[model samples]
Target: MYDEMSQLKNLLELIEEPSDINLDPEEKKAAQVERLFNMLFEEHEEHAKIVADQLNKSVEEIRSLPYSEFRKVANDLGVADSLLFKIPRLNRPRTFMSPKDKISSKLFEGVLPPGTNKAEIAMENKKSTKELSAFVSVDFDMLPNIHSSQEITAYDREVHDAIVSLYVDGENEYITNQMVYRTMTGDPTAKLTDKNRTEIDNSIRKCSMTRISIESSPQEAAVYGMQTMKYEGNLLYTKVVTGVQSGHINEWIYIMEQPILYRYATSKGQLSRTDINLLNTPVNKNAETLMLQGYLLRRIEAMKHPKYNKSYNILYDTIFKHLKIEAATSGALRKKHSKLRDTIKKILDDWIEKGFIVGYKNNSDKGKSKSLSIIIK
Candidate 1:
């Protein structure tokens, strides 16, 4: 039973690490049974004992039952197997990119400095100067024109027909006129209507199906071709713009899932993963950096609002306040303070090139030290 409990915990960890499990039908069935065992024997041990006691069975007997027999027992105990299976296992949130592999890949792609680590690359990418430099330095090779100018083949006609058919099939009376008008006059408000919006959304979804195929073809071709052209074609831009617009439609979803406010309140710090995700998303990275800077500045302002005297005193008071809210009787406040300080230091160092904050040497009556301050300008 103890061994089963340990295996169950290990399975939960695996599920949490790779949240989206893709398994064969037989494997999925086995995974479901494993999930049930984990939920009952590992996560809800005390509850499992209570259920076993009510059923006049020993915990060991319950653990030793076959999957089919366990299902029967669960049903008799009025426990929903489906509900238990659906419960998400808590896991450490993964960073947006793997530190080693992703950083090395970016360096080879010429998007990062040759010798930089993942943490350093992440920090550099957040800098405005580094971004501008990359934008200017990186050269995008163009795709070759494969078709001959004089020869008109059946394949050529078929490709053109396919592209045109895709466009025609996607059209709607509602947005077509507005889209035409917008094309003519360069005014987006010409297409501002519920019917037009719905039509545009439908068109975009249909277009996306083709775009994915086209994008995948280039990647497949790269395996064979020595000098692959990383083309910024019309299709690619259209897909990118559509994706950005779709993100706007789902803005509320992202905002609700944002870890900034929650992490600030609960952990008393921001994680690097949070910042990296924010930057990687289609939303404006510069604006996000400024927003983060503003949040930190606000915290500092609150601390020095003429009510709190010494900086250390402010820190102590803030820690105590959070401790009260958390009902933390242990040394949790001290642990949280350490995390907060580390988070602040990381942010200050990374966002320095954005001109949102600055770090300076602090040499007072004591030895030399370093301190961070908000760039007020």
Candidate 2:
């Protein structure tokens, strides 16, 4: 019942208004309301009937109820306030952006080797560890004319961050490429250049084209309180529209976020927050640095207590994998690994100096494999 109501709530909130006709405010609203009921009856007949029965009314009667009346009755039906509407949480900082924790923890990586467009990364679920094939595989198929790597890059992450910010629980967004650019640049007045527009366009297409497949064992399903669970879809559903009116060109991008992510975001312990300024931070403006900071932010946000150690250890190999760094030879790999350690330490030091963290430490593990783990504090 809750799920059914939730879907209806989303429908009421996100229904589009008629744009072609010129009508008075009341007439426009009346047209929209009529269309909404028609859609509910046609597409969601079963759920609409269920809701109607809950209100002691027939489906037709419920459909004919005034929009305001239906909303009032729905609210009176004991759905939690937060589930029905957006309510500010006390613990979250106003300036922070909350993304699904899995993505923040490296579901999508920086870059893949050229000529390869698929990534089969390990899913970060404890129950699935015993299963040999538990993974979240992503494949990006780009349109012909895009020159960059087809895999999800830091630039793609920027576009993703911007698009995810627009999602309220699970609502789709209608936006322009310029809007995406502005969101990333953190400037309302930022104008999209040809380069910026092209990047945004490519990123949007790649994200939509990217297919995600999650595989888990029966044990994993039981742990998640389900008999069977599977997810396979694009990260986002994107519709690109280009129209020429009176010799003027207009382009609109419509993005529908994946439903499972919304379910996770609204569920406990599955969402994480990061400083909204990270994307536009002047300290290290490069995409690689932004990606590193994003990965670190997830660790920071996972602190169990305020006074708990604000540091954690990550295997060098894991870091390399998350950053999608590769070397052709063993000697070259050692050199790149050493260089990466120093670079990461420098980046964390800069973060501390900029007051992003109170203090920082880079403690190399003292073990037989001494350089295996980098302790970031």
> Candidates' TM-scores?
0.21, 0.52
- Identify the leading candidate in terms of TM-score: 2
Range of the 10 consecutive residues with the lowest summed lDDT in candidate 1: 247-256
lDDT of each: 0.32, 0.53
Q: Candidate 1 regions off by >4 Å?
A: 1-36, 42-47, 50-56, 81-132, 135-377
| Number of the top lDDT candidate | 2
RMSD value for candidate 2: 14.0
Candidate 1 residue lDDT tens string, 1-377 = 23545543433343211221245435644554455466557755776688789888887798778656666666655553322322122122112111122222232223432111222222232333432111111121222122121222122211221222222332221122233223211223333455443333333322222211111133333433623322221221221100011111110000111111122222312212222222221121121222333234334434434544444222324323322324274577557544445554555555454443344222223631234333332
lDDT of 2 by residue, 1-377 (tens): 34666644544453334361356535655565465446446655676667778778997787666655755544454332312323222121123344544533354554233333444444445544554323455665543433445566655766776666555422335567766665555445566777677677667767776766655556556667776655677767866533222223344565655434434444425655545544344433344544565655555556433544533555556666666776899889788777666666675665566556566444454632222222333
The alpha-carbon deviation from the true structure for residue 197 of candidate 2, after best TM-score superposition, in angstroms, is 2.4
